[model samples]
Target: MLIGDVARRSGVSARMLRHYDALGLVRPTGRSHAGYREYSSKDIQRIFHIESLRSLGLSLREVRRALEDPSFTPAELVADLIRQTRERIAAETELLTRLRRIDAVEPSGWEDVFQIVALLQALGSKSAGKRQSAALSSVDDVPLPVEALVEAALSESDPNVAGALRWALAQSGEESLALLAEGLGSPAAEVRARAVQSIAEMPNDGATTLLREALTTPDLVVRRHAALALGVRGVADAVPTLIDMVVEGTNDVDAADALSALATRPASAKRIATKLADRLAEDGVEPPARRRLTQALADIPGPTASKALTDLSHDEDREVALTATYILGLRAAR
Candidate 1:
């Protein structure tokens, strides 16, 4: 078959066919004696596969790699491609839903928009899977109906629509929690941090467990966010972990946040102050470690911490003395 026949069967233009051939991605099966290109049925089949993969959102490079590597299973490649597409679609759908919800309301349309707003709020509270399904169910084909409802509400100036948008923004679900758990494995540290933060907002034993597990992450950002989340959740179970972070974590911000969280309880405050005082009194404690311990003690803000800081005011390190003095001043104010 000629290039025209390949184009017709593959639904790709002749020019793109030549481009694919030039890239060595779907070469012709044979050549005529006159030096013309010749494609066999096998070549057409290859083109179809390439097109199918492209439709599924694989880049040409990814397609080429999957095609050229014999060890790469087609099913695995397709599955990965599908997952990527789903993530993209999910993000897009969320953005569209927000936009539509904003546009759906009218001021003069109804005396009370509370019912519609409540429904939208309930919809938003559902898991992402449920939300996605609800959005899709409202439309014939496109996934924009939820957004359309929002848009209608916004346009009509309905108070219910405004309430719905706020509710959705605050919505939490198991699916969202699962998405966050999956993000913990992302290569980006920021993504992992955000995932942990989101999970902390929702009330779930599983979510808390995931946040606790994140405390052990090698990434300081992830560990920092986990500590902050644990504090926000006010989980007493996390106090020990947060204390460890204050004692040993590389990130000062994280340590500060953890110490602040731990300071909320008198028992925790006393415990942390005692630990810091012991560290300061140790002959073998390094200067830097000692300094960090002093800073954490000062941050705890109590009689025990203030007393420890006052004693440290006479230390050899001028910075430590100054910090201790500052802590004394802060404690005096209280």
Candidate 2:
């Protein structure tokens, strides 16, 4: 076949075939009596091989080395191609996510797009200060999509930056709640904890609903945080988990405070006192946890709490007895 026929038949353009010829990658195996370049069947076969390699993202040089080098191994080259392809895919995915976030915000012009892009870059910054600043400024100008704030809040490790991110997410109200719900179900314990903490900052009904759901989650961290949030909202369902937090010594003080807040109501105060008394009655209650429980009852009002306090004042453990005595005196003086 002549070069024209080979180009037409193989789908390799004539210019590309000439370039392959110049590079000695594929040369015409024969010449016609008319003096034009001519290719034998084997030469056309080589052109097909080069095209096949290029389709796998092989550079022309790599293709030449692949076809001509006797000792060339494809395993390493194929692995490298796979790695490169994965990197390219990751970059494209990140770009697409950013574009979608920007579009979701409904940017009014190029300036809004540029501002949002800058803010997003800052949110992902290596510097904690920069990230915190970005989070604080997120609501000032172009409203960033809640998804970005939720993403940042879930992964943030620094305490100050995490607080800022959580605050930013709270400002978005219910918008951040759905995204945070996904984080609550994440397999990573840290992510689930962060999700709960962020949700705890939002005071809306949607956030309250998520916290109620989080109370049922198996993660103790999630359950504790959700209970605390629920307690402040006057949701009595959090009462049991809040009591558990006190016994477990995880954020026990905050849990106690939440319980006290709920105890301000007449019926809730009586019910809370009964629950505390029940824990005291449990067979395996330890001195430390028992003492903590006694202290928790100090802030709760009503005759049930006073009776529970009165019984604890004469307990066998000196610390529990003293704590209960001190609380009784404080309640009596009031």
Candidate 3:
């Protein structure tokens, strides 16, 4: 086969085939009597091999080494190609996401497009200051995409930046609640925690509903965080989880505060006191945990809480007795 025939059949262009020959990658193994470069069957097969390697992201130099160097091992080269291809894919995927966000901004013209682009870049910047600035101003001028704010809030590692992003999401809209709720289902525990925290900051009824649902999720961290928030919202469903937080000693102070907040109504105060006394009565309730529970029960105003505390005032644990005695005295003074 001649160069043109090889180019036509193998899909390699004639110019490329000549370039390959010049590089000595694949020279025609036979020549016609008229002095033309004529390709033998083996030469055409080599051209196919070159194209095949190129498709796998091999540079021409690498392809030359792969085809001619007997000492070359393919394992390392193949692994390198895989790494490079993955990097290229990640870059392209990031670019595509940026483009989609920009389009979603519904830019009126070049200026709006530039503004969205700048904000996106800042949100993704390496500096925490830049990310926080972007988050703070995210609601400026053009209403920023809520999805962008949600993404930043879920992935942010810096506490200040995370707070700003959560604030941005809160200001963004009700749509943000759905996105943050989806983040709760993420496989990563940190993302789920962030999701619940962000949701906790949203004051809408939808956020409260989501928190009630989150109380049943398997992630204990998420459940605890959601429980704390729901307690502040006066959702009675958070009572069990809040009580658990007290016993577990994780954010027990905040948990106690939430419990106290929920105890505002006389009926709720009695019910909450009953639950605390029950947890305190459990067989395995240790002294320290029992102390925390007794302390948490002290803030309730009704007869049930006072009765529970009066009983605790004579408890076996000296510290529990001291705490109960001190709290009971305060209640008397009031």
Q: Candidate 1, residue 150: CA error in Å?
A: 20
Candidate 1: tens digits of C-alpha lDDT, residues 47-105: 98899878878889988988888888888887887798899999999867654554453
lDDT of predicted model 3 = 0.91
The reply for model 2, stretches above 4 Å from the true place, is none
Q: What is the C-alpha RMSD of each candidate to the true structure, in Å?
A: 14.5, 1.5, 2.8
Which has the greatest TM-score? 2
TM-score of each: 0.45, 0.95, 0.86
Q: Can you write out model 3's per-residue Cα lDDT over 215-325, one digit (the tens) per residue? A: 999999999989999999999999999999999899999999999999999999999999999999999987889999999987877999999999998998989989999
- Candidate 3 is scored at a TM of 0.86
Task: Kindly report which residue stretches of model 1 are placed more than 4 angstroms away from their true locations once superposed.
Answer: 1-170, 187-190, 203-205, 236-254, 278-292
Predictions in order: lDDT? 0.66, 0.92, 0.91
